[model samples]
Target chain A: MTDTSLIDTSPQGSTRRSWTFTIGAIVVGLHLVIGLSTLFWTPYDPTAMSGGRLEMPSLAHVAGTDRLGRDLFTLIMIGSRIALIVGTGAIVIGGLIGIAIGLLAAFASRTLDDMLAAGLDILIAFPTLLLAMLIVASSDGASLWTAIVAIGIANSAIVARLTRILAKRVLRMDYITASRISGTSWIGVVAIHILPNIWPTLLVNLALQFGLAVIAEASLSYLGLGTPPPNASWGRLLQEAQGTVYTAPLGAIAPGIALVSLVIGVNLLADGLRDIADPTRRRRR
Target chain B: MSPLLGIESLTIQAGGKPLVSNVSFSVAPGERLGLIGESGSGKSLTALASIGLLPDGLQASGSVLLDGRQVVGARDRDLVPLRGTVAAVVFQEPLTALDPLMTIGRQVGIAVRRRAKRDGHPTDSITVMGEVLDLLDQVSLPQPQRIAEAWPHEVSGGQRQRAAIAMALACKPKLLIADEPTTALDVTTQAEILKLLGQLVRERNMALLFISHDLPVVAGAVDRVVVLRHGSIVEQGPVATVFGQPSHEYTQSLVAAARAFDDALEIAP
Candidate 1:
């Protein structure tokens, strides 16, 4: 047998980290810095009609101005913050609910497990956007938290399905039996063995879910069922800029660029994380 | 002495079809019993049912008494206390038997801590680690400290099996059910693991239910043998009586095959 100890003694060996991870991290990091900076400072007030309307990119206004004369750059920066908030919030809510349901399904009695599996399949098959729209339309109309809750609930079905499949696979392994035979409780088994083994894959899936959540939030905002006025959501900016696109394209283009970059960054990060988290993939490289 | 493990007419069914039909066996305290069966013979299922660890969709009927506790139809919570304390199992594949994400030491430490808590001894991290190393040493693993820190993939198959044995030993179980523990190892490693298992069982006075398909291996480890075919017990007797003068046709064929293989090995240039 090949002795892996010599080469793979350290968990975080030098060759394990790849350039894909580096680039993705940098891109995500840049967005995070720009987004977080908005909490303390922005060059121009994002909500104020403080510049010449429909101006092109120039020294006075970096990304130019919107039809309402708000600083496009400031709005884009705030959009980053909103995107991050919605993504993080949605994942947290989705992950907790999904993981709990998935684990319950995994450890549940045969009849209950089947019922949960069928329920989850139906939920997964339903369109996420349509579900989000329904949720937004039903209760306390679209604010930031409402949009977050809607997207989060929409995201949970997919997360639950993935978690269920992954958890079941982990559960089938002999170690789980060994754990139980070792007197570890079911809760302890989940906490110690099942979760730790499945988290890397789950984490990669959650990162992709984070990207979807951002896009879903943007879509909701565009439909006017998301974060309302003065918040300057990228989708809201796109909606307002749709009419003035011919005269001034930057208004539409700036927010679109911000949204695309963040999503792409997240996707790349997920891809890189999968490569890093899986030792087989790392070894192959 | 009463049997540490007693299975009387155990029947395991999946999807209303019986997989193991009316199987019966008993293992007395400190006795070594070999369960001999080929793949799909339900030996593993019988072992699992003995501890109430049978997979979902497979229903077990009849009595499985482990240390006087009813394992058949027993609630998981009720079985939890009995497992690890009464009996601990070392599975066939050592690599998959251990948690890949955890270091060998930590996994063994969990068992050690559980045993300590059950015995109402000190369960602090330092004491647990100390006991973990002790178990590793008891398994005769070279450089116990290094083995403790190693991941499952980092070690050889034998070492991994040794570590798995260490984990099983950590619980200080009265009965050690080895379900083909040495089957996944190389020929040399298999012999070493079997030797280690025999020595440990002897040293700790733990009853051993050694399950395997290899006739010679089972004959060497166990005093008595239970031959199973297609989930049914064909014949069972003292290892010498059964292997020397087989009564059942299946057992006779098995003995013949083992003898043929042994002769082939002896004649090899």
Candidate 2:
């Protein structure tokens, strides 16, 4: 019913949108290539040491060596694998749980709504980082995924709250009313009428949530609150490089740049989805 | 004669405030009864309450009977089976009454399919489409198939109302509750719609509960007229008796207000 060619163009009439898309595609492409290459081989084992520590861009090490004499380039590649995994995992987990709670609160009126809202409010009131740290302390040590799950759990209340408010408003719209008037039950109204319209909102919101999740997981790893040693996350690599900030600053600078670039790429991708998913953008076009 | 539709002492309270209180009305099969009143006069509330479709938080009492079977106090589970089988509705703001996202054809097909599934009636989707086209033809919608394929927004106000009439008829319900079905339409479209509805009622021998604020439209379209003011039945009788000689002061005032507007429509004071 719609022309694919028209959709190919980004919502921002400006060329910046296309440039951002190209940059995102390249970063994502590099991330995938870097991750999958681990299944095959890196120039050197990511954790293996070469001749000496702080060996700058030698013929053998490619991107130079860390304080521990580990190849910085291989560490960067391996770190991306964790970043992609945690980022994707957190969004899926948080999005699904949040949407379930949201739909329940929106459709089930009064007492159920109050119960869910109160639960979310309590969770939201707690400090996310301190709560995650406390959880990690109280529980066993966290893995890369544990940090991701903790951050995702901490942030799900925002998604749930936003989804509930949006869903409740949508529940009162004429289309939903028509569904009920047509002999469709409340469950039917939500599944058939409400869900379809709110899907675009969910998608755009997911992109933003995933971006935040990546940053959270990376920070926790850097603070030694994430996946234990021998696991390389962007945060852990950056943490390991802290002692070498003087002579071999590239040890910190390389992973640091990777973390910022990945975050920037995800945020840009989210902006793109926002423009496309926004219904108002349709009229603008 | 058995009334095709009967509402007895229908009381509806919204937040402890009565919207329709102690209201009673009935219509025989093949008969048309107009419930006339000003805006917010409980006429529409009575119609909605009769069908057990009033919004939540509204309390309803009294008996609504269809084919002599009480329905008003019936359970939610029980009320649904009778919905499209025994009755259907046509509402004001035709486009809003319809699902804007669904095609008119699908809407009609849904009603027909629901009825056929419930009753074990013969139902080929194509046959149902043909039947819908026939209804659209009956409502005088030119290019019925094209109109059926169009969304509610694509059509003019008149076509949307015609589509609504077609939907209300899709299940072949014996009672059709038309609440301000013509109020949003233009004059020529209003005249055509009222005439079409009148003809449909006669042709199918169905009972009609016509709710509207316009006195002349109701006067011309119905056999009996019940005047309501502030949730109470003020006056009622054979259309000629009630309109020619209203028994209650509120009824007279309603007629006077209607007459003052020169058959266009009166703004109720």
Candidate 3:
């Protein structure tokens, strides 16, 4: 009876199984290829007015031309590159600063831990974009580096809060005590035991944060608090395309699709990665 | 010979409420002492205090001298050198005691490496691996090679406890504290672990501080027993005399319970 039921469910079960990771990877990978290829060549100089204004999709001007008379395809390729750069840079900055602060909070004394926790809570309560804008406004003027640093600093509070909670849970386990009793130093315990145990979860969160950073960067650019002209950030493309939307609808829709797809791809990737990293969850399915 | 562990007027408190109050006891070198109590009686807290490993927000007052070193109120840094050298602990739950991510061999190897480095011995990978396997073998774990390669979850409870014992013994500590080490195992596995622990302690000539709620298990493992009730010592004496003729009402009740359990087992067809 069990065998027959298992056989009947096999085909349906295979269909029901998740394909998010594969789809996410493919979408992200396509964007990456387009982004990287821009380093070597683009059909035309993205910043130059090489095409007629508001040209419809054609072999010469695929994705058409924007109001500025530049190839929309070239603008999007450059936009993908900037998006990836900001995502990678923000996540790197956030991961280092956040993990360090979180570990410190986990190991801190009662009073100190409470102070740090409260401080992190306040930082987290602020909107990421607003916080990024404040940072960007305060530190010189808006540029690619400024936006990256601002978004990173703004995102760190959430990451730190997550790391602290996870590290504290790991700290309470008996193996930690056993490790200590075995003469492992505090630093050694953090590196060997705490970090390895918590990293799988952290990796998933960081992937999600990557998507958020991409969106945050675009938002900053849209508000003119991001990279200046000629950089062609997706947010700027969407903003620039808005005036010409009725004449060349593709101009506005192109960047919008790019932004949505990247974020959705990363979110799906994170969801799939979680299942892969956690064996118990995989076994349950 | 000097006592390996001496606790005088030791009181452990959490949030200002005393959990183990004014608990006093001493264990001489090469002696086997049992701390028997019911759950929440503070037996585990006493063991933790001895090693200066009491959990956060819990403070231990008074003196706990282990190998002539003060454990009460000692800073963690000050206690590091003494840990796994002067004394080591085997906690109750073996599955939780060993790191889930690490292999049994690697965990044991870490302890061995630390001990070797402290003693100024060569800490090459080969020497450490050899020592890890030796310790696993000493614990009588079947196929030390296979057991060494297995993760904690892959092994049975009894094997895990044996591996835990091996990790503790890796330090060659002067004092070994087994805090309800076999409580999580079945009756058969418990007896086997108790036997393995007894053999290891005898072989090393290390002082043993066995903590358990099981009266029969404690009686079989130690020379003297300290009975704790509500975080205080109700009675303490040689196991034979204490079990044969108890003085405190609490001690008498504990003795009666053990006897009743044994009687039930004997009458069962």
Candidate 4:
């Protein structure tokens, strides 16, 4: 048996501050800062067509103006706000409902567990984008919150499935049986024993889901089922910039870069969290 | 007085097939009963049945009485209060018995709080902390304070086993079902754990159901021995009578093997 002193505790506590995690945090943080800042100030009004069309990058117009004569920088900044809202909103809706369903399935009787598993399998078989489109189509018109809700519902099935698998694995451990025999309530068992053991993996999955959420929102907007006109969605920006790409490529390039970078940042954050969650891996590193 | 624990023809079935059939035994308060059986001899199943923790898909048909209360067919709601107070269990694997994410103190504190709640006593942090420390000390762990704060993975195998026992003793249960509690420890650690269990049981006058596959291991710790093979009791008597003059062929063979194991250990060093 390995000596108790040989087991290091710092890896779990310190890995959150590691370089990969720090960089990820910064990337996500900058988008949040830009998103929130846009609520108060922007160089030019994003919705107002009060600038020269297809203007080049200048001191006054950092990213220049779009073909609609709206400030490109202002549009990009507000687009960041839309991305953050949809990403976080979808994640919250999906993660909560998914984890709850998964936990219920895990603790339920064998027949019920099988039923839930079958239902989740059917839900997963449908492509998330197609499911979101069907949901959005049900509404009279496209809107930001509607799109977020649709994407969230689509994301829930995947999250629920993952939670069930991970939670079932934890449930098999002897500690769970011991906890039950110790008279811990079912809720207490999940909170104190099951959750802590399964959180690391669930967290990583949630992070990846967050990244997928951002992309899903962007895709919806690009397909005209997302945030409607007057709101500057990055996907809308991509769509608007496509026509004028030959003349003003930066308009398209800026939102594209933001979308990719934010998703990359979230993925990187998930990787760092995985390392911290498993101390043996952190120690090996 | 009624026995602290009584098993009247306890039978366990899986998928309509009998796995353990009509196994009967009883342990008076403060008496140590050793259940000797091989892996598939239904020893562990009997122990689980005693506490109503049979695995999913296995139906138990029998009466398990603890202090004259029927536990075998009791609902989980009724069993909750009984567990950790009337009776508690220590599983075979110490490594997985204790919650890895929790401190030893916190884990033991849970059992303490549960018992206090059952007795209609309000529990404060100070009382819980004091009780946790006391339980650790009772298990003869080194530096109760240090052990209380340590995680299960941060302790030695012997220490972990001791902590598990402490948790089981937290409720001051009248019956302690130790199911191969020391099977995973080193030879020396095993002996220490067995001794600790024996001393605690004797001091508290708790009924002990010690289940193990090793016959010699049972001999030192129990007053009576029940030998099982293929889910039926082959022979059961006082430890001296069962060991000195076995009546069943299976019991005789088991005794022979146990004696051989002891001889091998003696000649090794």
Against the unseen true structure, what C-alpha lDDT does each candidate score?
0.89, 0.77, 0.89, 0.86
Q: For candidate 4, write residues B142-246 as lDDT tens digits.
A: 788878877677678888888888888887889899999889998899999999999999999998999998777899999999999999999999999999999
Off by over 4 Å in 4: A1-6, A9-17, A270-285, B120-122, B267-269
lDDT of 3 by residue, B13-33 (tens): 999999999989999989999
TM for every model, in the order presented, reads 0.94, 0.81, 0.91, 0.94
True-structure lDDT of candidate 1: 0.89
> A46-105, model 2: which lDDT tens digit per residue?
667864888988788777988888888888888888888887888778888888888888
TM-score of 2: 0.81
Candidate 2, residues B105-177, lDDT tens digits: the string is 8877777776677778778888788877887888888878777776666667888888888887877888888
In the range B20-124, model 1's lDDT, one tens digit per residue, is 999999999999999998899999999999999998889999999999999999899999999999999999987789888878899999899888888899999
Clashes of 4: 0
Query: What lDDT tens digits, residue by residue, belong to model 3 across residues A1-285?
Result: 122221112233232227887888888999899999999999999889988888889999889998878999999999999999999999999999999999999999999999999999999999999999999999889899999999998888989999999999999888898889989889999988999778879988898889999999999999999978878899999888778788778988999999999989887777677656643334223
iRMSD, per candidate, in listed order: 3.3, 5.9, 7.1, 3.5
> What tens digits encode model 4's per-residue C-alpha lDDT throughout A1-285?
333463445556464548788888889889899999998998777788867898888888888889978898888888889988888898899999999999999989999999999999999899988999999999987999899999899888988998899888888777677777777767888888887777778888888888888898889899899999888989989998999898789989988999999988887777787767753445432
TM-score of chain B of each: 0.98, 0.93, 0.98, 0.97
Would candidate 2 be rated incorrect, acceptable, medium or high by CAPRI criteria?
incorrect
Query: Local error of candidate 3 at A93, Å?
Result: 1.9
Residue A92, candidate 2: how far off, in angstroms? Answer: 3.0
DockQ of 3: 0.34
Lowest-sum lDDT 10-residue window in model 1 chain A:
A1-10
